[model samples]
Target: MIPFDLHTHCTLSFDGKSSAEDMVRRAAELGVKHYALTDHVDLGDHADPDFDLEATVSGAKKLLPALREKYADSIDLLYGVELGQFVHAPELAKKLLSENDYDFVIGSTHNIRGYDDFYFLDYKEYDPFRLLGTYFDELLESAETADFDVMGHITYPLRYITGDFGINVDLSQYAPIIDEILRALIKRGRGIEINTSGLRQKFGRIFPDEWIVKRYRELGGLILTIGSDAHCTDDLGKGIDEGIAVAKAAGFDRIAIFKYRKPTFIRI
Candidate 1:
């Protein structure tokens, strides 16, 4: 059984609906042994213009100790943040990492040079293929530049590929690029995540595709984490069992957990 959910969002996140205490209570109820609260931090001002970056970091620091004390015995709660990559905001990204001691840091490519097809509301002219290719390139660059503990959803742009966008991801076309990204992550000692939230979306699969996971293993990338990316209590632990099955099928014998920014591998 997969006992840890390393990527999630609580009230600290702008889109998060559940409080930290609520998430802890739900995790305990579901018999989850470990988890992390990885809230979204958009580097590009395009996603959420009203988000106060400094205040978000400050709030996260303030809540960590109490939550840690509250759930210390029953469940292990980790402090983390999900940073969106813009490449231009590398300095801000580094400053956040330097100032705090986070248990985990998730680097995600939410935009390609200030235009995010996924979260942007007025994305009418978005080209899926070009956006995907650009997103992958930016992700690889961010992995090299950003000092994050883990790379957030590897193939995040897939969520917006369907519906009105009329984009279909064949995976075979982007396999080599994804392999290069995974290889870069491995070289930098960063980990990849099995974002279960993707299953709830139209793609009906986790990030990076199953083939990416297999290639990651083939390239000696062992560090992996599973996340529901839940905004509410009910979404907690959703589709994680299937995620574990995917990981096992991809030849991963363990899942990585973080504590005070250090990784500890637990056998699945």
Candidate 2:
């Protein structure tokens, strides 16, 4: 059984379909002992300019207790938010994180230079090597600025670039940059996730790539988490077993789960 799924979305996020109740029920069915509802909190250029950050945190706090009680005996639920890096909104990101008591926070670079480049950017024009290098740089900057508990989807852009485009972006070529990012994350006490969502997408490879995972372990980065990044009920726990195998292959003997902001390690 999967130890915990720290990255998932319910109705709390913009694109999610399941409610917390449904998610809890599904997790119970899968024998998942711990889970986190990490909804997206976009800090990009186009997010509702007047969005109430305080209210968002308040709402999440208010809902956690009820959800926890409802699923008390079955599974543990963690309150989390996925914060995207806008680069320009560093202060806003810091403020939101400072004011909230999230059990876990995922720092993601969904935007570059205030633009939503995660999905909108075309991968064909530039050299794949250069593009990936730039992406890792941005990720490093985001991690340094936000100082979050975990780095979300370390190789996110690959989800859209590899298969149909037939671009052979070898992750090993960027090992030095990858090492820097992993080292920075380790220095900041941040964990990297095995985001299994890529398995269901065109990328066909897990985040951070296998080589990055191996290097991370070698660099003394032991804090690891597994997640589905599921937007719907059916996607929950998808490829989690494969994720565990990947982590074990990378030399991790345990995976982490969080509760009330405290990490509990589970043997793989």
Candidate 3:
């Protein structure tokens, strides 16, 4: 049984299709006892200038408590936000995080400086190595300063490189850069996530794959969270069993669940 899924998105996110209620119900059905609804929060350059967080935050306030109480007997629910590019908008990011009582936060950089998310861009147009180099650089910068329990999808841009474009990315070229990011998170007592969404995507492989997980373990990085990154009900808890196997093979006997931004390890 998949005990927990720490990263998820519901309709509160701009691109998500499932409701928190539906996601929660599906989790209970799948024997996932602990679940977190971490909708997206992209401030500043990550979002348009006029994009508002108020509506998203307000929706969360009304939905989370109701779902938590309704599922209290069957599931342990936590409210979370996946905040992007905090390094690009520290003041605004901190303000939004401060104004709400989020149980967990995921720091990510979906975009480079002036570009949109790699998902929206045409990967064929850019030099694969240079593009991923920039992507890793931004991730390193975010890791240096974003306030969050874990970094979401440590190798996200790879989705575009290896998945969408069907290009084989030489991860070796960026190992030193990735190590820098892992070390920064370790220094701050933060963690990284095993995002299971990759299984359903064209990549057909886990993000960062098993080797990265092994490297993180070798580096003394202890905190890890597993997630489906599900935007719909059918995908809920998907690949998490493999996620657990990955963690075990990487030397982790347990994974984490966050409450009030603090991690509590759960034995697998």
Candidate 4:
């Protein structure tokens, strides 16, 4: 498998620490064959007050061309976005997708309607089960209607709920809904990303977990991508080898890379 990481963040993201050039350079140095700068473009009322979509999109557009050329010998740098909350503002999402020639767009739901990001929520104060139910419902909606190449971190809420709070979630309860989400993605020719960020965090497993990956494969979902979800330079391509192992274990002979909004599979 080529060392690649399709999901990552840079200074353009509200929570990112490294700059785009820095992250891309680091990926090149690490021998990453394919690297994507998928910074956060989280939208809707639940989005951070400080996030500026126009600036983020324009800044990336300006910075990427030079960086891509500079690292062209070492890396294939892709300009991508982790677009969160597509269901919240469908028209705005459409507008953003139409305007920017994003090489990849990851449809994600950081929070449900009328709530903060799962990272900020006090799990003790809310019903985790209810939140997960809503989260999966929103994921299904994103799968059905969002303009994206892949669904980012399908079990995102668990990163905080179970990883931080040590709460054990009964994933079986959500299986039916998850199947619906997977089916929706497969039907639309969309994909899911196996986010490796959890491996370095309190969570010791990948996002969506192994069973989910296997299930997606079994359900005839062909598109799968792996990512570190790195927010800093040191974390670039982190755990990506392990992510490939997970993909292989899940029975995927090939993984995907996107450019011009079309998937090109790379054999693992």
User: lDDT score, residue 256, model 3?
Assistant: 89
Error of 2 at 148 (Å): 1.0
RMSD of 2: 2.3
Q: Give the runs in model 3 whose Cα sits over 4 Å from its true position.
A: 46-51
Tens-digit lDDT track of model 4 for 1-268: 3468999999999899998988988888788888899988888898999998889888888888678888888899988999999999999889988988888989889999999999999989999999999989899888888889999999999999999999999899999999999999999999999999999999889998989999999999999999999999989888888888999999999999998789999899
Per residue, candidate 1 scores C-alpha lDDT tens digits across 1-268 of 3398877888788888988789878887887888888888888657576677877889988887678888898888888888877475877777888888888888887777857437563435655777778778887887776787778778777676753354676868887888788889899888888899978877777876777888888999988888898898998998889889999999999998988778899888
Best by TM-score: 4
The model with the greatest lDDT is 4
TM-scores of the candidates in the order shown: 0.94, 0.91, 0.96, 0.98
In candidate 3, what residue range of length 10 has the lowest lDDT sum?
43-52
How does candidate 1 fare on TM-score? 0.94
Candidate 3 lDDT, tens digit per residue, 9-128?
999988789888999998998888889999988865657454467888889978997889899999999989898888888998888888888999988778888788878778667776
Worst 10-residue stretch by lDDT in candidate 4? 1-10
Q: Judging by TM-score, tell me the better candidate of 1 and 3.
A: 3
Candidate 1 runs further than 4 Å off: 121-124, 163-166
What is the Å distance of residue 137 in model 3 from its true position? 1.3
Alpha-carbon error at 39 in model 1, in Å?
Answer: 0.9
RMSD of 1: 1.7
